[model samples]
Target: MIDQYSFLRPWLFCLDPEKAHNLTLSNLDRAERWGLLQRFITKPIADPHTLCGIQFPNPVGLAAGLDKDGKHIDSLAALGFGFLEIGTVTPRAQPGNPKPRMFRLPEAEGIINRMGFNNDGVDACVARVRKSKFWQSGGVLGLNIGKNASTPIEQASQDYVFAMAAVYEIASYITVNISSPNTQHLRSLQSEEMLRSLLHDLSEERKKLSDRYGVHKPLFLKIAPDLDQEDIHLIAELLVEFGIDAVIATNTTISRETVKGMEYGEEAGGLSGAPVRAASSQVIKTLKARLGNALPIIGVGGILSGADAREKVMAGASLIQLYSGLIYRGPELVNECANALRR
Candidate 1:
């Protein structure tokens, strides 16, 4: 039951946020191994939707950043996610920003993390994916890629191209992540000039990879929730122009207007959860208006309930994803959202 998480939240909150995060995943792995997960977790509803040539079992998905290394794929899939996305992974392993980089704002149902792209690198993540039963069975997995922290912003395209080539054959679709706020200057890739160049390079690389593999893998761009009307319009135009498969609208927000005056409210990082629900929806609604059906939108931000999930669809998202919501609502939230989005 979803209330199981409510019971456990108090104890988890007592520990440091990152430590609690790791402990939860570690225990989940054990539970899945012992066959306890399938017994306790509800099965996801069957509501298949096809986009970018991949058939999703349901519209609700586990967003990237949770399983940064593909370490808990089989375990997380047991919780009823229709699809699972992993990473913000880079070309090389990284230690990330520093300790105490993640903060929780229980009063506001939000989390702020500047963990950078802390991951074990793309090669390791690829190996883990290859070993996964889910991937072996052709699960719809999206590999979110990014550049190394040490790489200059000007040469970031090289890093994206390198990572994309590594996961080309294994991924259901590749998400070019250029919106994470944690990495210094990472968000600069969103600028029209820089974005155009990056997209050009990625498109060229995709052509070569597709010809080599004899199958076309879709590319989806992940954008921030912190853009203006002008930026949104420009991005929508670019997506259509480049023939991008889909767009993941509204990553974590740097704006703290909603959670101000609360504990850890002023922490320096992108804020997610309920505080971002409205902003993310607004972005989805605007993108839908501009892009229409020329491109699909994968809405992911502060979806904590079935109603929130439906709202994303109402704003024209073909699919939805969850991250912080899992921390607050637990595994049952997956089934709840899937059922709500079922037509």
Candidate 2:
């Protein structure tokens, strides 16, 4: 079966990355409407795991970028992801960078994108999730929120707080995304001083929302894979100090080392896929060592196979997520990787 599906890859790889992504997502949406996706693909692995006060049927999750606006949650959920993360949603909707902003590095099983955090905004995203049958199922759903592109760095925390308040009602977990490389100066938010202040404010907001809604959802911070050991240690210290519920060990990286000679390697955005495995694993290991069971870590980046998934778990990731790997390996990758974890 996997061999038969291999034929689809060459054709999918031929199109531009962004267009190929839209086409794939649209096809999945259609498959869900016809009730055919499940017949063809097995359901996600069902070994339940708990983290940060929520239960996930499996450690495998679909990362944030793939379903940015919460538009295709039902369809994506049907593809058998244990958890779905939607959006790098901002306070206000904004059109991101101009076309040809996404590139594929097939040679490295990687993708480079500078989409600039394009999305339909937090309110619309929350509304879509609320309306979706997927959310109603009580499946783990994470909202990855970011600042609007035009927002100044000084006021970025305001945007995070605003989006958090807007989606707190429906989100199973909320991820504070300060690592997207496409946005101008967004990574700067990861600095110790800036990150401490941001998490401090967001932490207070989470408590208030928990009290008001009578539910305490985990708040996780998503950092970049581009950080060095020093950077990871500093951020981990603050994560502990701020009482954050979890750490999403990585977002896409700005490093071009993996796809050095590829045509798209020089594209100006974050890179994700096979090449990121080593760097991302290092981040997870460092965090686990520093925080030592105090904070859970969601390992993501370059998870292309079962071995890669197992490596992350060994490195101390309580859960794992994939975006670029799914694009390259297809849905079977999910079950294959999860089954490996069970062993």
Worst 10 residues of 2 by lDDT: 1-10
Task: Give the worst 10-residue stretch by lDDT in candidate 1.
Answer: 334-343
Q: Tell me the spans in candidate 2 whose CA falls farther than 4 Å from its real position.
A: 1-4
31, model 2: CA deviation in Å?
0.6
* Pairs in steric clash, model 1: none
Q: Which RMSD values do the candidates have, in order?
A: 0.7, 1.1
Candidate 2 matches the true fold with a TM-score of: 0.98
- Per-residue CA lDDT of candidate 1, range 58-147, in tens? 888989999999999999988888899999889999999988999999988899999999999999999999999889988899999999
Judge candidate 1 against the unseen true structure and give its global Cα lDDT, from 0 to 1: 0.93
Q: Residue 54 in candidate 2 has what lDDT?
A: 87
Q: How high is the CA lDDT of each candidate model?
A: 0.93, 0.89
